[model samples]
Target: MPHSIPLIRAAAITPIRRWVEERGEDVGPFLARADLSWVPADDPALPVPLRSVVRLLVEISRAAGPDTPHRIVNGRGGFEIGLIGRAAFRGPTVRDGFARIARMMPAHCTHEIFTVALSGDGLHIRDGWAYDLGDDEALYLVQQYVASLIDMICSVAHPEAPRAERVEMVPHPEAGLNHLRPWLGDRLQPAPLRALDFLVGSDVAAQRFPKGAQERAREANGETGRRIASGASLADQVSALVAVMLPRTTPHLDRVAAAAGISGRTLRRALRQNGTSFSDVVERTRAQIAVDRVRNDTDVSLGSIAADLGYANQATLSRAVRRWTGQTPRSLRSGLKSRIEPGKPVSETRLSK
Candidate 1:
């Protein structure tokens, strides 16, 4: 019997698509082969099946060449950080950056974990997965994710900031050195370990960037952290799906269930066991999204916010906000206006009843 397939963030496979397109090869067929033809290629937060992603990589590697994985993750895009990653890569020191990435990654991707550890030798940034996938495909993902981390560090600091003493990944028979050597040089090595590690030097780890704290990145991190802390319950998953689909359309139970790779009845039962319902999840999701947009994004008008959250009109959104936060949308925005004036610390700005 096939074990349950794990859901990963849709952004996880974006680089592969971009790489294939850049090489003049059609990515549609590869996506179809992996049963991902229905996934919206642009939406990064939508959940996708991990098994399908692995199969898609395997098929692409078979056609493109042994170096496909390394070539695709050339560290040019630095997209792995997503919204939360902006704050993660902006930490005081390289060590703090690694620690922040490890903590915040769960909000962007599931069935995978990142760890940062300090040993006598050096600081280690590692990737571990919860799903059982083929070695070659798994190695492909590790290669991409590990390189993206280095790229994220370079994005905030200098290109030569992250000095890796050594890099290690699980050994694969088809893995080639031609492409990896140009990037990692002699530091890339094959090992029996299941995870990939980038062992960094002490000096590089402690090196700090010039730019101080950024308010936008901090707010993004805080919001994502609260969502991830809600746990991986069915309700939380449904809520996340609703949030992603809100701007597009009303995320019905069946549509969300299909995205989750389950039936609506099954999802309903699971949520019931967890003490929640579909309507409850949707309402809560809309309330939170409305508040966040109203409080932080001043450029977006109330009507636009209402439309994005699937509200029928501004009055409906105002009522929902009042019920959720004990304040109308205008009141919440007005409360935050003064705190956002020039020279006011963004950290002092808070939306309250």
Candidate 2:
């Protein structure tokens, strides 16, 4: 019999698998229970029933505590490493990015529809699901989707990242409230799940990407536009230096600036001209290096890999790997290909110190 339930892309739940493994538990039992054991680890775009995925998340949450959903979606990379994020970041502004994501999201998951609106000088985002999965499953799914959406918006905005002034979420237990308070803070209010909502300021949301088109053209013409007549692109140069320095010490802005024979302020200005911040470059460098090492070097211990990548320990690197690839290091080393891609230079160049 053909089932009528909506389907979510299998890629959407890889993070859940990584989380289960990170806790030192086997994923076979969980996948077996969800009837998802047949889903190939290598195939990301395969479809699985949305109800099954939500139930799997709810099951994990029950086993791991309410924080599982938050941890899965609230990580640094969020959805930007995925397909929708690549298309969205290529947009002209933060608000445009949201629109692109809203339009393209259905191709990734059918259960939810994303809507973006302008309310005077602010932006309102709403996530409306096609069908209810009941309270427990709905709560976890809402957290996973909504948090990823907010993080995607903020990441595209970069340094001028807009703050979510008000957010309304489905009612939760007090323990769940505590887990969420750190991220949503005082802006959170209990509301029905008709639609999950968030509001962000217009100025940052409307900040134009002055260099987006030019940079994209340049990258297409050359190999990532690594060079110019005078020297390498400052951002590329800084990334190279950071990658080299990761194993030795923290690539602090001041230290990296000195290595590049420029003052910290001057280096910051150069990177800003290239449409990135010091922290952003460092983050990209770390993600690229981490993915390369994990995918290519199966014999390397994760602890060693973490130390080489400047992470404090294996567990920290594991979380970062999960965020970047939606899979754990072991999973990646064992043959799961990373689905992350580097986003375009979409951040607006800011002059303010």
Candidate 3:
């Protein structure tokens, strides 16, 4: 069987609790419902189920009303930047910090993937889901996440640093614009994708953190990363590696083992210890990448997706889709397309089984 996706660190919810209470709303019941037991001050590092975090946000929004999402997210700024934030702040330069955060996001929040890329005149930071947040909640969640990122960037950035030139999101109603204005200002614009652009100067990117702060932060982050990796079984690591490799080439045990810095025999021994095989990891990785691409990228055709996954043809992909999802490739594609329609409920799009 494929390994279960990792849970998100509890620190992700710290800001929510803080903002909710600041609004004078009782958060105890909701936290209990979400099964969260600690506050931001507690500095809890325990991982919580991603569904529970989503549920907590949904429940908080319901209780606090529709504007709560914007209010809470904006009010807290980047106070709840989580583990990724901590590690990033410890880096020597702003660019280095942002890069580190992007790399560490997968270990912290496996439900979404983030990328920082350089555009012609500026840097474009894009975010896409590894799992669906559904349509009803997607906008608010996306806003909250993107806003938090903007806040983090602004906090450490020099006064002369690159300003956020543009902020884009899936089209949303005009009502929420008020809450976003303080952070995003006039830069907010509607786009087909979710991304933020920063016009950073070389000096800004090179600005160093305070003396010894970067080193201490890096050490702490390294320890945290190690702990996170140490918790995963060897099979889980191989599966993650295979997932990343599938888009570029067919992942083999030897390559995977080399990537893991182990001999093939040792890799086999590790997997056997974990009660799995190399082939099992490959299938699970392919199955995961297939579903993710299908659900997230509507413009990409089935044949193209199959080719990316190293499938000989779309027919093989269709068969594999049927086996994995109990639905044909066309049907799966249709469901994904339908979910992307504006105002449609997104409860049906599930990545975790």
Single out the weakest 10-residue window by summed lDDT for candidate 2. 222-231
For residues 1-353, could you state the per-residue lDDT of candidate 2 as single tens digits? 11123555666677777767777899888776665665666555554556657767777777777666767655444332244544455666767767776876776665577788997877788877766656744564565456655755465455433367777766554454556677667877765655778776777677654465324522332112111111246676566656645654566776566544357888788778778888877887788888889888778888899887767788887887788788988788888878777744322112122
lDDT, each prediction = 0.64, 0.63, 0.60
The residue-by-residue lDDT of candidate 1 on 1-353, one tens digit each, is 21233566666677778888888878999987876776777676566656677778788877877666656765553444354455455676767877877776776556677788996645788877766566665565555555555644644555573367788876555554445666667887875576777787776777665554344354442234422322356677667656666676556777666655568888777777767667767766666677889987889998998877766788877766676666767778886432222111122111110
Cα lDDT for residue 341, candidate 1: 22
Q: Model 3, which residues run further than 4 Å from truth?
A: 1-6, 35-43, 62-80, 159-162, 172-179, 194-206, 210-223, 226-353
Candidate 3, pairs of clashing residues: none
lDDT for 30 (candidate 2): 76
- Between candidates 2 and 3, the lDDT winner: 2
Residue pairs in candidate 1 whose N, alpha carbon or C atoms collide under 3 angstroms = none
Kindly indicate the candidate among 1 and 2 with the higher TM-score: 1
TM-score of 1: 0.59
Number of clashes found in candidate 1: 0
